[model samples]
Target: MGIVSTYLRAFNTNKLDPYPVEILKRVDKPTTVVLESEIPRLDERESGFNRAHRGDFGPHLTRERQRFVGKHPLSAALGNMQFTLAHVVDGIVAQEKAPLPNDPALMARHIKETAYFLRADIVAVSELPSYAVYSHSMATGEPVELNHKYAISIIVDQDWKTAEATVGNDWISNSMSFVAYSTSGFIACILADYIRRLGYPARAHHARNYQVVIPPILLKAGIGEMCRIGDIVLNPFLGPRFKAAVVTTDLPLAVDKPIDFGLQDFCSKCGKCARYCPTGSISFGEKVTRNGYEKWPNDMEKCTRGRVGNTKGSGCGVCVAVCSWNKPYTPFHRLVQWSMRNIPVARRFAVWGDDLLGYGQPKLKNKWWLDLEEVDGKLIVPTQAGQRGNHRRKQA
Candidate 1:
């Protein structure tokens, strides 16, 4: 057998060494519990939370409102609906496992069509490298192994409406996280079921519970290239304002080629995300060797610690919000990104122009959600004393 075939057989037999579980187990469990409990309360107090702890771009809630429509009931309902449909699709795919489908290309196309119909902004397939699956899951400290050889990476767009609403308060920002996670989870679950129905072994990798690193798989799938912000950068679309989920399987499919869009060159000069990172976790230097790869290395520990220490919410995405690449689907910006892809010299100018236009500045006036009177008929405004207390404890 060829080397690739041999490795595949070995992987299927579960002979590969699993990732160490101890690293994951080391996190303080009590702290996690406390964070989980605070998420909802934090969502309610988003404006107060931001007012208390101002960062480089000002109150995070204010910035969010400028970008998104805030926590609208319709958007939240749509997210939940998409999630439910994903589960239904999963069931259908699982039950239809074939006497083996005849054509791999046709099958892949159908899968992509189904995924797009289910609310995925983009879908692509690629061979899953053995290294893509982690040695262990950090959340549960569980030893994990993946025998699957293919992965389907799905990207979902964050609502521009909700992102615009973020500037009003913390509730809007937290709600976006809620929508993305819930929607991505549903997509992964359904895709996993679909692969299994084709008589192939499959598994869904969702947020905080993934076996595979998403960005690499996304790159392999021809969906997008890795940008300076260390996330998969989509083109002529949602840019960096998207979340990813993966479904690994043994299904046969064609792979995609990596695209060159001058992102590396642009990132070398543009430190927008690094500057906007509230925890200073993003890198601002040249790419360096880490685990045998040349890339920007982030301070993952510091990032997580910052999230844990946040008195208002579960996590942060200030880097994402402020990135020049995080553009809405506007004709003017689309033309700019398209031009930058073809003309290498225009990249630096593009980056500079984005900054000059105040692209990264937070907007305070768009705070529509701050006027919210109540939810479920009970008033939810933050008490003045509580707001003051949180502000006093803000980190410099």
Candidate 2:
């Protein structure tokens, strides 16, 4: 067998090491989930944030969208940096192709290595699915006609220390998202530009500028499985605690298959995210087929309201903070994670143990950020803050 085939087989059989960083290298095909029907193309304008911006959710959410970034000073700063790089996602390509070996496997390996070198938490490549491309851009009301052959998916972890500290909907919420967004965008931009220098058509898709849907690309790239948090893909290691950026290109490269890692079974039984969601947006029922995929669907309007119209905090990440898979990578935790993946019988205990150990509760001792919000162009600590912890208690 070829090296890639051998590695994939080893991964499928669980022969490789189970380290967090090495998880991507071991994945082959999805163990449980399967795409039974063709997914329909979607417009970017139909997304939750865009719907909120257009006042579909309500006037409150539309107004909140305007101040969503600037409401938190740290988020404003980080968002500024991210927005600045959006302009460079696509640029001129070299006229002459570089003299390089025509090996897809080698190219894929090099690209993944470069992404890791750029500080990406995880990286994977997959064939770009046509349905994954948005029919129209949200920023500009023009058609998105990206025909890139491959997608290089880059994931960046939002600092676990910060995630562990707050109540997951406090002042630091948007900052955590922006940090990952900006870092992943930066890496994707550079990677796309590098590919263009080799005379290939390439484009970077990130938070500030995206022509493609992330969850499908993430799934096709073997990044993670669609968890119970609606459309969010959850890595066995990072859960839903990270953000993604994609580099689409005509550059030849090997593609990764979707992975399972027992996420569907685990997410079905563990409803901690649904239990802790401040607005109760996540569904606690069985997975339903939505737009061709079988998954739990969240209330988009409610989710948007909790995020954009949030008064007690900047933006919500309560689900990310409370997921059973979102654990620190200590040795013991890693062993438990492995069991959660391979041992189906252990999943129930794992779910129960997560709540028993208070894993999803806010770690006030780890709190590092100051609770500040920008209002009317002035920084102030609002008196309405700190109620999310109380809300969590009430829910418990």
Identify the candidate with maximal lDDT: 2
- How would you encode candidate 2's per-residue C-alpha lDDT over 1-396 as one tens digit per residue? 232443354346433223333443345655435463567889999988889989898787888899999898889999999989989999999999999789998888888888888999889899998999999999889998999899999999998888887788888899999999999999999999999999998999999999999988898888888888888988887889999999999999988777767888888778888778888788878888777787887998888888898898999998888888888776577678777877898999999999899888888898888889888878998776534532332233
State each model's CA lDDT, in order.
0.55, 0.84
Over 1-396, each residue of candidate 1 has an lDDT whose tens digit, in order, gives 232342344345342112111111111111101122222111211222233333323455344333222233434454455545443433333454577568887777777777776787777778876555666654445666668778887777777654543431244554555577667778778777767777666777765356666765676565555555543354335656678888887778765445455566677777777766666667776676544345666775455444434333323566666677777755466567666655678888887898789775555465454422223435445332001011111133
Model 1 local distance difference test score = 0.55
- Cα lDDT of candidate 2 equals 0.84
Off by over 4 Å in 1: 1-101, 138-140, 164-169, 231-236, 312-314, 368-396
State residue 80's C-alpha deviation in candidate 1, in Å: 11
- How many steric overlaps are in each model, in order? 22, 0
lDDT for position 273 in model 1: 73
User: Pairing residues by index, what is the TM-score of model 1?
Assistant: 0.67
